[model samples]
Target: MGMSAGYELSRRGLKTLLIDAFDPPHPNGSHHGEPRLIRHAYSGGPAYVKLALRADELWRELEEATGEKLLERAGVLNIADPDVYSYAGRFQDAADHGVRIEDLDADQIRFRWPDVRIPDHYRAMFEPNAGYLYSEKCVAAYKKLALHSGASLLPNTFVKRIQAERSFVSVFTNTEHFIANHVILSAGAWFKTLEPFVRLPIRSVRKVVGWFEPSVSSFEAGTFPGFTFASSLGSYYGFPDIAGAGVKIGRHETGEEWQPGEDLVPFGAYSEDEGDLRKALEAYMPDAAGKLLKSAVCKYEHTPDDHFIIDTHPEHSNVILAGGFSGHGFKFASVVGEILANQIELGHWGRDVGLFSAARFSPISP
Candidate 1:
């Protein structure tokens, strides 16, 4: 999010400084893990579908600007029970947005994707144009573009404190202090550290993602599509084997809360890290649950509403806070950055940003 905003802000002739606690494209944050799904017909809410569509366009533009393979058009499948909120939300939002979605029963899903073995009661919404983005590369591409556009970066630097004033914001780091007319506080998982600056009911959690060897060849990137499934058991999302990476899957909800400055206990810290993922795979795609090849532990920052908070700071208008993406924010990174840049310059964005405003929650009192 910071990198994308930096690129947009700098390219528009605004002196932008992007400070990261660690070098991005690093697995410490949520933007890594190879392929991240992007569904236009969103299940989160209708407000996100428009952002997703705009992000799709910007991602393509970023690819053209970077000349790198940033996104793929390999389609995505949303499977859930009829009464499940995800299934109904996705269907209604898709219809409202006019995004073409193919309604499929369990049989059709099995016929097209033979690995899936959903029960007869389950239904599916297939978004053929939706796809996944190369998470790390997208960051790298944006970083390069931001640098070329005259954006300065300070990696491996932690913000010790932030002093938001009426005229400008002072950002103090472990090494140095910098001041700017506007500051974009996109702390990602470490957002809790902001304390009094941000008190928006945001919590960071330890999320585990795994890649499993598939017994079926249909799990390959070209043959298979990314999938997000919701059932009585739980909500799950996965990606096809890209570049021999194996079928990547991760549970949507239920993760341990993560503190700001703590090293994750790795993927195997608990048995469920793999066991839970295996259970989902075995239940839905038994053919793709052969063996666990690898797994990763990342952070998930979420709002109470499970939606995103991308607006200016409540106390300090000069500072913008863009976070609480929950689990489904990466694909919106491109547009989030664009909107952040817009917020900094125009003090307002083109779209109805009420859903992402910080006013919904009171700022933490120091």
Candidate 2:
């Protein structure tokens, strides 16, 4: 969100200054993990579908402008047992948003992809336009574009304090202090550090993502698509073997509670996560069950409702806060960036961001 917002704000002739604690395209934040899923049939609601559509357009635009392949349109498959969870809402959202999709039953899924072992009670929704985004490449592209558009990106600069006044905001870093007419706090898990200035009900959880070598060529990129499955165990999502990276998988609903500034568990430290993933593969995708090659820990900053908080500071309108992405917010980063830039320049973004307002939370006395 910071990179995209900085690019858009600077393109609109605003003196945008982007500050980050670590150099971007680094593995410290949630934007790591090689690839992130991007789909149009948003389970969040129809509002997200709209944003994702716009984001899809902007991603293509960015790709054309930068000549970088950021989005891979292999496809996305959402499968779940009828008794576990119904994906009817996903299909409905796709229809409402004019996104092309195909509803398939377990037999059809099994016939279409022989490697997948779907039970007879399961159903699936396939969105041909849905795929994965090269997350790191997207950030690098956005940062490059932002710099080209006259934005100053200060990396490895830790922000110690942010004082938002009625007119301008003063940001104090470890080394120096800078002032700006407007400020955007897109800090992921670190948003909690702003305490009295900006308060939101957000929790950061540690998540583990694993990559396993596919036993067959059917799980490769050209043949297989990105997929999500919900069952009695939990919800699992994964990608095909892209660039020989292996089939990356992660359990969406289970993770350990994490906080910023704490030591992160080293990659491959948790064998439990690997075991869980292997069990999931044994049930749904037997062919994908292979050697667990690598795994890494990431953070998810979630709100109570799992919706995003893209609104202004309760006390200061010059300050914008964009956090609480939960686990499924990266797909809309492009549109969210535009919205943040719009909020800073126009005092209000044109989109229907009422669902993401900080005002939805009870006022915290500053």
Candidate 3:
């Protein structure tokens, strides 16, 4: 997020510095191989549709500027029971904003995509504009463009302390200290470490993902589109094969939580968490769950309500904080970068962020 924000600032001709604890595309952070879904008709809420729209535009702009295809239009299928997960908000928002979505029933789904076998009780909302972000490629492009736009990026340098004053912010590192007119905390998991900011109610949860290599080649890239299944137990999402990683699948919700500084290495190093996920896959998506190639774990910064927190610091107006993406924040990274830049330069973003305000979690100041 910091790298993308720095690219935006540099494009606007602002002096910006990007700092990260590890390399830009390193797996030490959350922005990784986990495929981020970009859906305009969001089930989380409709307010995000506006931001999703702006994010699409910014993603295209970045792709054009960097000459890299960051957003892939493979389309997304949001599957659920019509009565349970009604598409009232998502459908209305998409219509208001001119986003396209295709409604599909079980028979219609089987007809369109025979490889998928959804039950008659299930329904799907398909967004033609949705697809994968090719995260690593996008990060590389953003870093390249940020450097070309005169932004200084210091990788492998960890931020030690942040001293906020009336006018500017003093950022301290292990080796040196620097002052900036504004500061934005786009750190993924270390967000709660900032003491001056409000103590956000966030949980850093450990999530495991698996990529299954189907014995047959039917579920490969050209044959399947990304889909999310909502079953009686819980929800799970998967992606089609694109990078030879096979059918990547993960549970929408995780089981355990951890602190930011905790070593994120796998518990047993080589042990696979497949036993738990396999039960889900076998019940929800049996065909695609047949063969398992590999499995790994990642971290998710979850808020109390699982929505994002994209607002400025309460005490210091010059400092902005973007965190608590939960597990659904990466798809909107392009617009998030733009919003952070806009907030730092103009003091406010035009979009309605009432749903994501830090004030929602505020306690009574008695």
Candidate 4:
């Protein structure tokens, strides 16, 4: 979110600086995984249909601007047993938003993607336009553009303190303190440790994703679409094999509570890191449920409700807070960045952000 916002802020000739505790595209936050799913026609918590569509536009624009293969047009499939809340919500959402979804029965799904071995009662919604963004490359593309647009970046500079005053914001880093006319604190899990801002409603948790070796070539990209499956067991999301990288899958919910400043326990540190994803695969996607190849651990800063926090600071209007993305935020990075930039530069966002307001939680002290 910070990187995309930085690109927008800087691209428009605003004096901008992007500060990162670790060099960006680095494996610290949620953006580390190779591919982050970018599907629409929503449901789960809030309505993100329009926001997601606009993000699709911006992603295409970024692809044109950078000439980098950022997003894959492999499409996305949402499958679950009949009458599932979240899965059914996607159908209603698609209908309401005029988003077209190709309905598929379990037999069709199995036929289309031979590696899937779902039950006969399962159903699916296929969004041909939906797929994923090469997350690290997206960040790297934004970084290059932001720098070319004359933005200063302070990589490896950990921000120790931030004071959002009535007029301007003062940011204290490990080396020096700098005051700015405005600030966008797009800190992820690290938002919890920012002293004065700690009172805000966001909790950090650790999550893991893994690449599993599949038994067959039928699971390769183009042959299969990115998919999210929900069952009585749990929810899981995955990508088809790309260039022999294997099927990358992750759990949608549940992770150990994590404190921001501590060193992240590595991916394979826990048995469940691989076991959890393996469980989901064994049940619904048995064909691609081969041996685990590799894994990665990521952090999510979630609000009480899993919706995002993209509103202004309750205390300082000049300070924009963009965290609490929960789990499903990477896809919105492009639009969220623009929204943050608009909130600062234009003083108003064209779209309604009522759902992302922090006021939903109990008030925090100034």
Can you list the residue pairs that collide in candidate 1?
none
Give the TM-scores of the predictions, in the order they appear. 0.97, 0.98, 0.93, 0.96
Better by TM-score, candidate 2 or 1: 2
For candidate 1, what is the lDDT? 0.87
Q: What is each predicted model's overall lDDT from 0 to 1?
A: 0.87, 0.88, 0.78, 0.86
Task: Give the per-residue lDDT of model 2 (tens digit) for 160-232.
Answer: 8988778899999988999999998999977777776777788998888888888899899988999999999
Q: Which stretches of candidate 3 lie over 4 Å from their true place?
A: 82-84, 196-198, 265-272, 363-366
Clashes of each: 0, 0, 0, 0
Native RMSD of candidate 4 (Å): 1.6
**Reference-based TM-score, model 3:** 0.93
Q: What's the distance in Å from true for residue 32, model 4? A: 0.6
Per-residue alpha-carbon lDDT of model 4 for 143-251, expressed as tens digits?
A: 9999999999999998898887799899998789998999998888888667675367888999999998888888899888899988886788999999988999998
Instruction: Name the top lDDT candidate.
Output: 2
Q: Highest TM-score among the candidates is held by which one?
A: 2
Which sections of candidate 4 miss by over 4 Å? 44-46, 83-86
Q: Mark the regions of model 1 whose C-alpha exceeds 4 Å error after superposition.
A: 83-86
TM-score of predicted structure 4: 0.96
Model 2: colliding residue pairs: none
